[model samples]
Structures are given as structure tokens and as C-alpha cells.
Target chain A: MYFGPPGNTLVIVVSPPPDRPGLPARRVTIADIARAAGVSIAVVSYAVNGRPGVSAATRERVLRIAEEYRWQPSAAARSMHTGPRAVGLVVSTAAGGVSSASSFLDLVTAIQDVFGKHGYALLLKVVESVDAAVATYRTWWAERRFDVMIVTDVLSQDPRVEALRALRAPAVVVGAPAAAQGLTSVHLDDAEAFGRVASYLIGLGHRDVAVVTGQPELHRTQVRVAALARMLKDAGGSLLRMTTDAGPEEAAAATRQLLTSPVPPSVIVYDSDQMALAALDVARRLGVEVPWDLSILAASDSALCRLSTPALTALPSPLRELGTAVGDAVLAVLNGQSATSHVVPVGGLAIRGSTGPLARRTKQ
Target chain B: MYFGPPGNTLVIVVSPPPDRPGLPARRVTIADIARAAGVSIAVVSYAVNGRPGVSAATRERVLRIAEEYRWQPSAAARSMHTGPRAVGLVVSTAAGGVSSASSFLDLVTAIQDVFGKHGYALLLKVVESVDAAVATYRTWWAERRFDVMIVTDVLSQDPRVEALRALRAPAVVVGAPAAAQGLTSVHLDDAEAFGRVASYLIGLGHRDVAVVTGQPELHRTQVRVAALARMLKDAGGSLLRMTTDAGPEEAAAATRQLLTSPVPPSVIVYDSDQMALAALDVARRLGVEVPWDLSILAASDSALCRLSTPALTALPSPLRELGTAVGDAVLAVLNGQSATSHVVPVGGLAIRGSTGPLARRTKQ
Candidate 1:
């Protein structure tokens, strides 16, 4: 190949044929013409690509230069003309390296199942701290790696929601959009879950009750606690205790303190089924009989909860369903369609041997 | 821009263009050169790209074409010339969307932590059925989306190991790779965990013992059961009863049946801290006294286990550390470095008040 100043450009004899016999391939690109014409690159782009702003004479000149070079972009380049096909999912988990709730895990599976069916593969990146979560959103937006992002375990006034808005990026939150204003959100009716459990305990004739929950700072926990308090007040009874655990150990310690209190409630309610089991152990250690001396209720029930001694009275909450619903809402928002805040109803209360009419009190 | 037969090649004229700029736009691509080169596109690609076999003169001609067009692929494409930077983790859970063990969850978090620190993001995809798991792996491979893959909760003679081999993708598994043949793997010393628990119980003067575990098919469970069998045999007493729970309900039901048997074991060793609580509950319901009729041993201790009634006896297992170690191994393997299979030692047995010397029997 040979090149020189424009009009007198010389074409030299090339060597060595491709190994493949009888196959002639032709793929050209605009860059070739720009070099041949000694013109600015964008002028070449405007001339051959037919994009606007270049004069017809200039466009014609650029095409003539490109023709002399016989340049074309490869098939791969032609395909690039189409829109980006890959969809991106930015999975944000709560900080502290905590695994998401069981229900959220299930929901993730369901959402993945649905997305996979639609030929979209989910891409996950764990967002450790709130700051890191914000950074991830910013990075993903600037790079445009994903078509949509799903933020999960949203907090009241999640900073990420604002980050997404600032970038004008599409996002769906998997918890109440407490501070997200117009962002799409999905979550379970925690108040209802709380009200049901409180009502069930009251129906069983338990006036004194205790509630143990996870981190009080979690929005859902606050909602449930408030609901429990309101229900107890309306029922002409008062909650004996409300404690929270950052994790299982804290839950167990709370159980011990609550159970051994001078005036322990006859029944205990746990925010998570796992914590409820801890409470059961505390009761057993104290020689307190379940359903006989102390009844137990689980706001969130699972196989583990149901199988606890005396079979706990529980709220039938489906976590997997909630996760999938959030995922669906995210997809809708990303697709430029407005989606309503999704509220998955918790299942009705599950009554088991864990609850019995208050043991008849004997006159002292 | 204009194009014609070889000699009447394309030309691009930059009119009022070189100095005019707003935000200095990116360059155009080879496709623009093709349109200018006039010959059925391939001619331009054949000429300017100089990809060989284009006659010398034709190659020179194509170069002239590109020079006229002035196009180039995006900088993003240039950076991607090496490959994608992320790794994919396909977490396989048990049937019914159940997550892997808590230890595994910790490991995942740890792995993510380490990987993120090293400038690589971990991509998590949860697969339920084994078939779906394999399919997801194949899809990811076909797309070349991940640099390396991590498969967890390895089954006995898992098909994924073999499938991964066929794919020849770099991967680090979280179980014994011996069965996996050529694939690299990291394994936990299950036998050690069980041995520690068994020895703890034997030291407590308990000859009769029961074990509760998860699905028997799990490789770790089998290892624990085998270790328990061998150790118990040495003590002149073999395992009295060993049961598995597909979930918590089955575990509780099994515990109920075990305790209600004609002769219940004096001590129960639980596979998980969660299951141990269930065993404790069974003892309480049967009116059995701890340390007197029942001594409980929690095999895997978490913070939750320590806070259980009697502050349960448990094996000090560090899941987060193991997870981080595995994650490092994955990154190493992906980076073309050799990673040895590491077996992190389990922490020593933490004996709490849950177990005590066996009750002395008086002659009738």
C-alpha cells in the first residue's frame, strides 16, 4: 500500500494473499478515506455516514476520497449501528455484609427466572456501604453498562435514590421508596403483618405481650413496632416489651432479659422466625413452658418457625414473592413505563398449637 | 465524500471544519469509509484496512479511502480489547429456592469483599435446579461475560464440574475438587468440625448421641456423618440416631420423633445452630431436663449459637474468613496465577453450659 499528498496519491502493489483460497472479503471503514483526503476526521464521518451538518460539496469530496481508498468498516462495525443489547442489573445489598432476607433471596430467584425467560441475563454487583452503593450507581450510569438497575433493601431516605435521579438513570427500588419520591418501589405490608400478629395475640386473650425485632433503624421494623403498639392500645392492653437484635445473638440476649424480667409477659412475638426460635430456647432454659407458661408468635413464618416447639402462631409472609415483585417493578420502570408502588399482601395468620387460651389463673 | 472505480477513489473535503468545535467530538468509524469507497463496500475494506490478499495497489487504494473518511472505533472498544473485568458466581441453592448454608452466605460476602477490594466485582446468579445451574453457566460462557466463575454447594459428582471442564473456563469451586477431577476447588474440613463436636461430647461423659443434619446428599453432610460414625465407634458407642431435614419443618418433625422414641439418645449434636434450637425444643416438650436427660451440642456455632439457652456448646467455625479465602483463590485463578486448594482450620470447640457430665445412675 502507498500514500502521498491527495491528488497525486500513489497506489503500490501489495503482497501475500490470505491463506483461505477462493474467498474474497471486503470490509471498509471511513478512516481510510480521511487519511486519503488529509481532511479532519469528523468531515469524513459526515460525508460517508450521511449524518447532518456537512455541505453537499464537502460530503461529496469526502466520499470521493473514500472511494479512492475502497475503505469500509467491518461487518462487526455495521452491527454496532444497532442499539446496545446487553441489559445490566446493579444488585445493591445492605451494608455490613449481611445476606438479604430469605424472601428477598427467593424474589431474586424469581426475578432472575423471569428476566432469563425474556433473554436478559442479570448482572449482580454487591454494594457494601451506602457510599459504595452510590458510587456504583454513578459508575454504571457514566459507563452505561446496564439498561436498568435494581436497588434493594431500601432504607428510609436512601441516598441511592437521589443518586439515580441525579444521573437520570432508570432504577427500581425493592423496598418502600420512603424518600425516593417518584421512584418505583415494592414491599410487603409490614403494618398489616404487625397488626395481624398483635390482633392474634389479643384474640388468644393475652394482655401482656413482648415484641423482639431486628435492627430498629430498619424502616420495616419501625412500621411493625408502631402497628403493634397501636393495636395493643386499641385492644385495651399494653405491650410489655419491645426489643431489637442486630443479629441472632442480640435477639437471644434480649430474650433472656425479657423472659427473666420480674414481670415477664406471658407471650413473646419475634420479628423474624429465626429470633423466635432463640426466644423459645430462653423459655426452655428458664423452665417456662411454651403455650402453657408462655405463648410464641412469629411475624414472619417459615418452616423453621412452624416446627418450633408448640408450633408457633405465625404471619404467613412470602419473601420470594416480594423479591420477584420488586424485580418486576424495576423492569417496568426501566422500560420507560410508569409503575405503581407494588404492595404484596402478607398471608393470613397461621394458628398452631403454640397458642392456647390464657391458663386459668388460680386464686392466690 | 465521493467514491468510484479504483482510480476515481473517494474524497472527503473538510470545509469550515478543522477549527470549528463545541466539545471536540469523537471520531467516525470505518463504516463511513465504506460508503465513500463506492465499490460494493468490501472493496474499500479490502483496500484501506490492508488486511492482506488485497492486491498491493488495491490495499493502497483502501488506505486512501480510510484517510478520506477519518474514522476510528470508540475508546471504550479499545479498552475492552483486553476483555471484561468482572467474574461471575453462580450460587446453586437447594430445591424449593432454599439458600445454601449460612456459612456459604458468609463465604459469598467474604469473597465479594476480597474481590471488590482487588478491583473486580463479583456477579452473583442464583440457580435453583441443577439443570438451570448448568444452563446459566453455558450461557455466561457463550457470551464471554465473566472472566472466571465460582460454583458453590457442590453436589456429589456434580455435573457442573464436568460441564465446566468441557467449557474450559477458569473457575474455583468451594468443595472437594478431587471428585471434580481437573478443576480446582477449596474445601472445608467437615470431618474436623464434626470430630471436634464429637470429642467435646465424649469428654462430657455422654456415650449416647444423636445427630441432625441437612440433606444427606450434600457432600459436607456426608463427610460429617462419616466422621461422626468413625469417632463414635472409637468411643465404643456409635451414632444412636442421625436424621436429615429437607427444611426446618422436616427437621423439627424428625426431632419430635427422635425424642419420642422408645429410648432417646442422651445427647443430640445438631448440624446447624438453627436446628440445634429445634432439638432443644424437642427435649423441653418431652419434659426432659438439660444436663440431666438431654445434653445438646451445636455443631456449627455463630453468634446466635453462643446466645442460645445454656449458651450452647459449638464448633468455632469461621465462615467469613473461608469465604474471603475462596474469593481470593477465584481472583488468583482468573488472573492466570496458580492457587492452591486451601483448607482453613476450624476454630477450636467452644464449650458452653449446654453439655455437662452424664447423670449417674443408681442401682434399682
Candidate 2:
């Protein structure tokens, strides 16, 4: 049995189980009893505690199922009555991605600061993959280690969201709105931000634009690609997109390929400050003058962007604000407020020496 | 009362407290009772739990004091008996410091990987100052949130070490050997790394060397400065040192100042990869061609150092190995081993395009 939002709840009914006189092989969870009883977990809870909610027959059936299964509330379940006063965040990325994730650290610091003031500690875990992250969340949730969880790097079909939903854990996703999948989220207006970037580049007379971005599967990457492609097509220009693992080597290789192509892009944008910096290095190595023969821009800004040679043009990520918003969303969920999504506004583009007007071809 | 290593212990004596018949004003901790009873925390634990290690009279005295103070073991303390199976790490730095700390993130990822395999999660906190870090540790320790703590960015006179000792918490300091201050630590040989840098610069026929480093009060900074000064003095060369808050702007300003100086050094070394990259930008802006008119090196290496224009010469920080060593030290301490320090060997300098032979002056 499953529980949905209040007033619009959906419950699945299961066939009655056969009577088994033998003891169970392992400790049975409330979820297990709920499944066997063909009722929602809340109904099982009400039945076991003798609360006045379900009908007498239904309550008896739930209680009998629980007894047959030898179900006992876990220490974690019992402790939930007294909150743990902590939040869990798992960053599922490769080891290389960790070092290049300066904005991520900034977001963490902001979230920690807000949560700390509210007497909640952030329990952080960094894993290699989303599947590992889901496993971690399960262990943490089963232990009742935290009152809420903050989910990041939301994919198109994230398993973490489903896992959290199954456990009915309070959670807030931090990613694009479309990727939240009905879960509460604090996200950036990626479509609007990408549209602004496209307008800015096109307004600067760039016709052939190229974007070197992270994995194509990431929701944000897909959103940005679609937005840029739409705007470029409307303007009768072509958009070329290349994907990398968000590593400097991969970004550099992509940049090299783009630069050596038959019809090289006049303006190239990168998904991260590190990737943009890598593109800069590749351009310098190839003797291509930045903002002259080629223009470069970064999707995210950092100290690296500000201090790099020629100073990269970038769209500054409002990580601190986004973190605070996520913290607020977590607090609201913990406070029993209905889950709602928030969109934090992003700042405008920071124009620097790396980007310039597309110059006319001398030979043509 | 105090406890040292198992064999050679020092216990302080305190006068008996006045009898209090009323309930306490606030919840009393075991430490308070231990202080009034003039016994170590271990003795208090044994007395409270009816263990046989302490004398009957001492146990009676301890119990009487505990009762008078209305002392009850904290939930955290009770949970400690069952083991929380988690480790704590606090990165106390300013907000800007968090973004520039890529190597710190690398170290965290490596540590997390090791601890995760051991079924231990890392509880991380980033604060603005060491005092705040100490306060955070106190809160975490009082709650018994983690079984062990990993202390980073150790100062010359660190209060955290003393605080951890007072709490009797298992901990491992990650910094210079001198900074550990009798605590268990995993350290890199800063003196040897600085000596190598000094030798390398002098070998390149550079008579004047400049070092741009973090706050002078930092233990690692002082160690590097002293070692570099000693090496330069022995070689009949002069050394110039400047300190910054480890921000890119300050580093760039220092670089600009060094380049415009009447007798600017031929080789300038930066304490971090970010600072070196900032200096590279500054040198370019000032028309000081890298490795031709000026040479640059970084004390720590990262992908930034490798991909920067001219490719900064650096000493690769073995952060992964150091993190693993720290993890091992943490496990050893948790397993009741005596506090013993471990020194991880540093790798040799990675000479890149930034450093070269000092060119003869054309107009000097």
C-alpha cells in the first residue's frame, strides 16, 4: 500500500496473505506490513497505535497482518517522534568532478550556514554515482539520521526521487524544475537563463555558435541546448553542441576539435568555469586570439573566471541564494508545510574581454 | 581530573564540592561531576556504570558528586556505547576560502571514499574561524554525533587541539607536525618541500626569490618561510616574502607589486595554484613574459596549475595518500591505539613551462 498527498490520496489493495505459523526470517518493517495488509502506511500506523481513523474491520485486518509479520517499529521510526535535527546531502560525482566543483562548495557553505543557524547540521556524503547516492539515502533514511534530505544533480529520471518517495522521506530537489518530477524543488530558471544567453550572443552578431557542455543526459544541459537551438534556428543560424565529462582534458579535446573544424564557430560557450578556462588554454595553444578570431563565454562564473587571462565572460551562478532557498524548502517540509517548488532569480551576464563582436572574414 | 595514555597518566585533584539537596538549575554533564570529584572522565564512566576499575571509596565519591549535580548521561553519551560509526570534519575558513580550496575538496573526496568503505560517514562543517570551529566541535562532541573527528588547517597555537583534549574525543589533526601539538596527526614534511622549491629556484640561476603565501601565522606558512629563508641564506641569496588572505585579488596585487619593483625577483613562488594562476595573469598584464622575464611556481598543484597559460611549475600535493593516512590514523585511535603521529612523504616538484633559467638582463 502507498500513501499520496492528503485529500487526494491513492491506496493500492493487495490480496489477503496465506496464514503462516512459522516465525519470520528477519525483522519486518512497517512498510512491509503495510504492503501485506493492503493499506496505506498511515492506516497501519493508526491501527497499531489504536488511533481513531480507520474502520474497525480495516483496523483489525491491518493489526492482524502486522502481528503475523511480527512487525515492530524500528528505533529509527520511534526516534522520528523526536527529530534528529539534521539534514542529509549526497553529492554523486566522480572524484575529478569534486575538485572542479567550486560552485558546489559555495552552495554547500551557504546551505550549512542557514541550516546551522536553525540548529540543524548537514550530513554530507559524496558518492561516485546516482545509484550509490540512492543507496546512501536509503541507509540514512532507514536509520532516521536526518529530518530531511537535499537531493542535487537531479537527472531526467532520477532514482533518488523514487527512492525518497517510497520511504516517504521529506526531501527537496535542487535542479531544473522539469527534473523534479512532482517533488518539491528549489531550482534556477534554466530556460530563461539560457534564452538570455542566446539573445546576448546573437545580439553580438554571432551566427555560428558552439556550446561545449557536460553530459547530454543532464536536464540542465538538455534545457540549455534546446533553448540555444531554438533561438539560433529562429535567427537562421546553426547551433553546434558537443558534450564532455566536465573534465578539463575532455573539454580541451572538444575545444580543439571545434577550432579545427571546417566551419569553426565564432563564439563558443562552456558549461563550467573550468571547462571555459580549458577552452581558453586550447585557444592560446592553437595561436587563436580570444575575442578576435574566437569568443569564449562560461555558463558559470567564479574567481577562476574573474582572474583568468582575458577574463572570461560568464553568467554568475547564484549558488548562495539557491542554497538558502533549498534550506528554506527543507525547513518548510520539516515544519509539515505542503511541498512547493521555488525558482531563484539568476543574475545577468558578466561581460568581459573573452567575448566580443563577431568580426567579418577577411578572405571571404 | 585528567587522563593521559594508558601507562603514564596525570590526574589533577579537586576539592570536594558542597552538598546540594535541590535539583540542579540545568542539566549537568559528566565532565562537571568528574571535575568536582577529582577523577578522570574514564573513572567517572567506570563509577557510573559499576565497573571494577576504580576504588570503592572513589566510586562512592564520584556517585555522590554526580547525584548532587543531578547528572544524567546524555542521549549522545548513551548512544556512544552502541557506536554512531561516523567521523566529523570541520573546515573553518572564510566564505571566499571555500571556493579557492580545490585541494581541500580533493582531500575530502579521498577521505570520504576511505571512510565510506569502512562504513563510516564524514560529518563536515565549514566555519569562518577557528574559534567557531572549536565551538562547533564542542556542540558535536556534547551530542556525541561522531566517533572521531578530523581537524584540518592546523594553526601554530590551535585551540581546537586543547578543546578536543578537554572533551576526550578521538581526533586526528591534518597539518604540519609542529601544529599537531602532542595530538595524533597526519602531516606532510613542509620543510622538505620548501627546501626542494628553494633548491630548484637557486639551481635555475635565480639569486633573488619572492614567495607569496597565506597568513604568516599559519603553521605551514611559517614552516615554509623559515625553510626557504634558511636555504636562501645558505646559498647567499635574498628572499622576499609577502602575505595575503589567499584571495586572487590580493595575490594579483602582490604579483603586480613584485613585477614593478625596481629589483624584482626573477622567480616568484605562490603558496597555492590559484594564487600562481593569478600571478600568471598579472605578469601577462605587466608584459613580464613567463619563464623569459619572470618565472613562476606553485607550492600546491591541481588541474588549474596544469592547464593554466604557461602551465605553472608546482609541487603536486599527494592529497589522496594523505587523506588515506589520516583515515588510518583515525581508525587506529578509535581502536584504542596510543596517540601516534604519522608523516606522509611529499612528491617532488613538477617542473612545467612556468619556471625556466633566469635570463641575462639586456639593459641592467
Candidate 3:
């Protein structure tokens, strides 16, 4: 496969068709080209607009017929052939919502670095919901404003996948393969990461474990929950699950509720490093000694985890590598490759001062 | 001041001039219109492209002459008139660099929310340096890819401002007015905020103070340092300044160096909450008691500051309000209005557990 040299100019050549006697009376439309090429209008559109889905031969035939018929594209369609290269990424969240996960920004930076090297700008739109994101994508697609799209936070049975499929837009999803619904995806092995967590906790002779995770609806959250639950059960241990909005206060509230419960677990695991830090604050306030009366673990690691009072034992997700993988997938899709999924490796659990043997939990 | 209704469609009308005897022998170009209108090619180009820096009357005249000559715009110029409305924001930072200040993401979200309401998309590009950022802006300007640009992290003598001015690109700087170099700016009252910090610390009976700040070249950092240093001198107290790359390790190292020095200040202030948190970790390892043996403060506030072991006292910059102000400035520039700077209100210092009266300190 040829990866063209990075540059500002984009060259798409369309040779003139066999000589015709005269120009048509009326202007040639996409419908005329579709009929002449013996293909559906969508196929003609995909070919004419330089979008993915149609084969190279089909695109060439459609273009030749379009040239022969003297078809003129609207300004919006014309811009697609002349505009600066760009990729659209619509983030569905409330204002300031993205700040909660610095990892999101890291991922964006990584992706931008890759696309920038390939001479493509990232067009970002922050909307309020998945429906709005889908609508934004539809509008951008209709305008032919960008060459490709990057879809993140893929949901179970996401509508975006189907929407992009129908539009024949080239896109890459940054989530699990199952959630991607056959689209190209770059994701971490959440199940494998969580399995390592369970083994480490079970090795500490802890039979009872509790998990504090973000929104339960997230496919990532579900995957980790399933993996940890399965592993704990296999070890003859029990698992308790609690969910938060991924905010520090919510995480603290969940931690408080767990510690005061009639039967609190021997260890508590948090989905994010920030959430785990909040739990540490809550534990300190409740006069619970870490790794002595209780244990704490963060599923995601960051500088915060390394510097916290009792440095948190965490499963480090390779966010930069994951981002690079996502960027590569985007480039592949844009280059007309078939949809493929990539699973980047996750690092081993970093054992710190946060976790200890269940025998130390005398109060429990 | 007509603030057009928010929508995707952009209409630029150029009506045909009074009947000309006959069409020109050759295609008319911007140069032909410029010659006919008795203006420089730049002026005519600006007028024809609907960009700023051209008077309304001159633009009208240029448009009429161009229509009279039957001049047609290139594909790029035509796209400027019909493409979806967008604003560009190029962040000059290394990959994963933006993750350090979650506040940056908050600002982006806030800005995106306002622009989204106005039917504009935010096109983001993250580059490695200011020079690259300016080059990106120049390319985008030539392509007419965006309606306005949002500039951030203004330096004492920024080349970006000069470049944008030369291109006559409508832009808004998110920094001090002095640093904006005649461009519209949205900024916090850094002097006022720093003055408040100075007074609060001095009122607590602290004599000597040390500040751990990010890159000193940043306009924001310079303003803060000058304000704090001047105020400290006026109050008969000495000030020590330390700079960092805004990384947690650097902040920690700075804190350790200060603590192990021959003479440590009674109080320490940090440029960011993350740095302040790192300082707390350093203080803990050094056996220095916060608010007792030493006082700590953060210039920017966040949930981490509120939830730290010894909750940090911080000056909360109204990032959301600042972002809204920036959005408004961008819209004003797009609507053919003159450039103007805006200063959003900053909240007063929030006194928390980390700071206390200097009388409580005895180690010195």
C-alpha cells in the first residue's frame, strides 16, 4: 500500500470521457450520473465525493460518466475536492465535562500529533448528547466538510456506526471492537487488565472486594466489571459493585457509603486515579488506615497515583500508545483499507503501598 | 450590530452590475478588480473574500466591479462563502502536554459550548511551538478554512499576533491586553488576582514568600510574578521566584530545593493546582506540616485542591466565564466589528486548610 508523502496539496484527476456530439440541454445531476453508470445514487455520490465504500473501478467509471455529461457540483460538493484536509471529532458531553478525564485530552493530543504529521487538521465539536453528536456528523457529512471522522466513547449498539455506514463516511472508533459494530477500532484490553487486578487482589488473600466505577452504561465499565467479577468468582471470592459519575465528590460519596455499610469489603478498587485519590481522602477522614484496615487500588494510573500519600497500586493504561493506534487506524481507513480493529497492550499492575493482605483487616 | 441567527447556511450575495457592453475577452481576476477599484490587491482580495480589514463601502465597490467584469472566484474562495461556519484554535504544546492543566480543557469546553450555540464548529490543532501555530494559522487563513481564530498563551513579544495582523485574520487572544498587540483579547485581571493573593498572605502575618511558577515567558506568569513581587516589596517582605516546566516532578523538585535551602520562606504559592499538590507531597516527605511549619497556596483552583490531604487555599480563575468572553469576542470579530479586549471577573481567594498565620510557623 502506498502512503503518499505528507503535503498541503491533494491531487484527484478525472480524465475526459469519449467525445460527445453536443452538451446536454439541462445541467447533469448526480441522478443522471448514477443512471449512466448503472449504479445507485449513493454509490455515485460516494464515488463522486471521494468517500469510501465504492470500489476504485466503480468510482473511476462514475467519474468518467460525470465528466462526459458535464456535471457541475454544488459549492459544498466542490469544496470537498479543494478544501484543506481535515477530520471531524464530535465529543458528546456537557460544558467542562471533558476536564474530568485528563486522559481524554492526552488521547486528543496524541491523535492530533499523528494527523498533523499527515497534514490533516482535527475539527472538534463538543455537543450535549449522542443524538446531537450523530446530528452533527450528519450535517458535516452532508456538507462534505471533512475527509474522515474519529468517533469516541462508543456505546453498546451505538447509532453513530450505522449513521456513518449509511453515509459511506470513512471513520474510526476509539473503543472496544464489540462496541465498534464492525467499524475500525483501537481499544485497550480491559478484560485482560482487570484480570490482572483480580489476581493481584486475590493473591493478597482478600475474598471480598468492592469496585467503584464510572457510569455503568459505558462499555469499558461493563467489560472491566465482567472480567473482575468472573476472576473473583473463579477464586471463590465475592464482588460488590458501585457506580459514580466519575467525579471526585461522587467517588468520595460512594467510598463513604461503602465504608459505613453493614458489610464493607476488605478492599476497594476505583476506576480512575482521581476517584481513587478521593477515596483516600475519604478513608483518611474516616480514620481508616490504608493497607491496614482497608486497601485501595486505582484501575487507571497517572502522576497523581504515583504521588498520592500511600502511592496507589494501579493498572496503567497505555493512553499514548492507544492514541497512536487510533491515529493509525484513522489513516488506514482514509487510505481505503478494510475495517480492522487493534488492541494495544496494557501494562502490569503497579503494586505500591495501597494494597495489603486481608489478614491486616482485623476490624473487618 | 446584526448578530445573525445561528444556522449552517452562509449566504454571500454578489449582484450583477449595470449592463456592460460585452463580456471580457479573458477571465477577470482579483488583480483586474483591484485595478478597476483603484485599490491594492490585498485590499481588493480582503473585500472580495469578506474578510476583515476592508471598509464596508470599499467592499461593496469591489464586489460591484468584480460582478461587472464577470469575475469568478476560485474553488477555495467560493468555499469561504458557502462552507459551514467554523472558528480555529491552535494550541502550541507537545503531545500530552495539555493534560497537565485540566483547566485548559475546561476553557475549551466552555468556548465550544458558546460557539456551538452560534452554529460554529471549533477546529483545533495542537502543535509543538508558537512558530508552528502561526504557520498553521497562515495556511488556514489562505484556505479560508475558518471564520475566526482563537489565540492563547500569548508571549511578551508573540510572533503570532504580528502574523495574524499581517494576514488580517479576525482573531481573539486569551491573555493580557498588553500581550494581545492590538488584537481583541479575553483575559483575567491577573494584577488584581495576584494582589488579592498577596494581601491575603500578608494579612496572615507572613513575611517572606516563594512562588513556584510555570514558564516565566508566559504573559500570565510574568504579570503574576511582577504583581506579587511588587506587592511583597511594598509590604516590606522578600519574594523568591522559581520556574518550572509545569510538570509535577519539576514542581516537587522545586519544593524540595526550597525546603532544603539555607533559608526557606514562610509561605509558598504555586502557579497551578497540580503543582501545589506536588508541593504537598514534597512537604509530606520532608516532614513539614502544612499551615503550621509551612503554608501553601494554589493560584488556580480545582476539585483536586478541594480534596487534597490538607485542602489547598486557591484563587479560582473563572475559566468558564473567560471562555464565554472569548467566544463573544470571536463572534464580534466575525460580524465585522472593531477589535476590543474583555476582562472577566475573577473570584476572591478561597481560604482552606493549607494556609495559616505565620505565627504558627517556628522551624525558621
* Candidate 3 residue lDDT tens string, B241-294: 998887777888999999989888889999888789889988998999998989
Q: TM-score for each prediction?
A: 0.73, 0.77, 0.78
Residue runs of model 1 more than 4 Å from their true location after superposition: A1-104, A177-179, A201-210, A233-243, A255-268, A284-295, A353-364, B1-79, B95-104, B202-210, B240-246, B257-266, B357-364
Give candidate 1's error at residue B336 in angstroms: 0.4
Q: Which stretches of candidate 2 lie above 4 Å from their native place? A: A1-81, A95-100, A360-363, B1-80, B95-100
Write candidate 2's Cα lDDT for B117-223 as tens digits.
77677787878888888898876754556778888877788898877765567889887667776778998888898999889888988879999988776777888
Please give fnat for model 1.
Answer: 0.28
Chain A: TM-score in each candidate? 0.72, 0.76, 0.76
Query: Model 2, A105: alpha-carbon shift in Å?
Result: 2.6
Residue-wise lDDT of candidate 1 within B1-364, one digit each (tens)? 2235556544443222344321112233455555444544566555644565456655565576554443433323422444445677776666322534445445656777777675555556677677777887766655445677887767777787777766666888777656445676787787787887777778877777788777666666778788888888899876865556445555667777877787777787776776776666666676777767778877667766676666778876677777877887887787788546778777787878778887833212
Lowest lDDT block of 10, candidate 1 chain B? B20-29
CA error at residue A191 for candidate 3, angstroms: 0.9
**Candidate 3 lDDT score relative to the true structure:** 0.78
Candidate 2's displacement at residue B62, Å, is 42
Q: Of the true interface contacts, what fraction does each candidate have?
A: 0.28, 0.28, 0.31
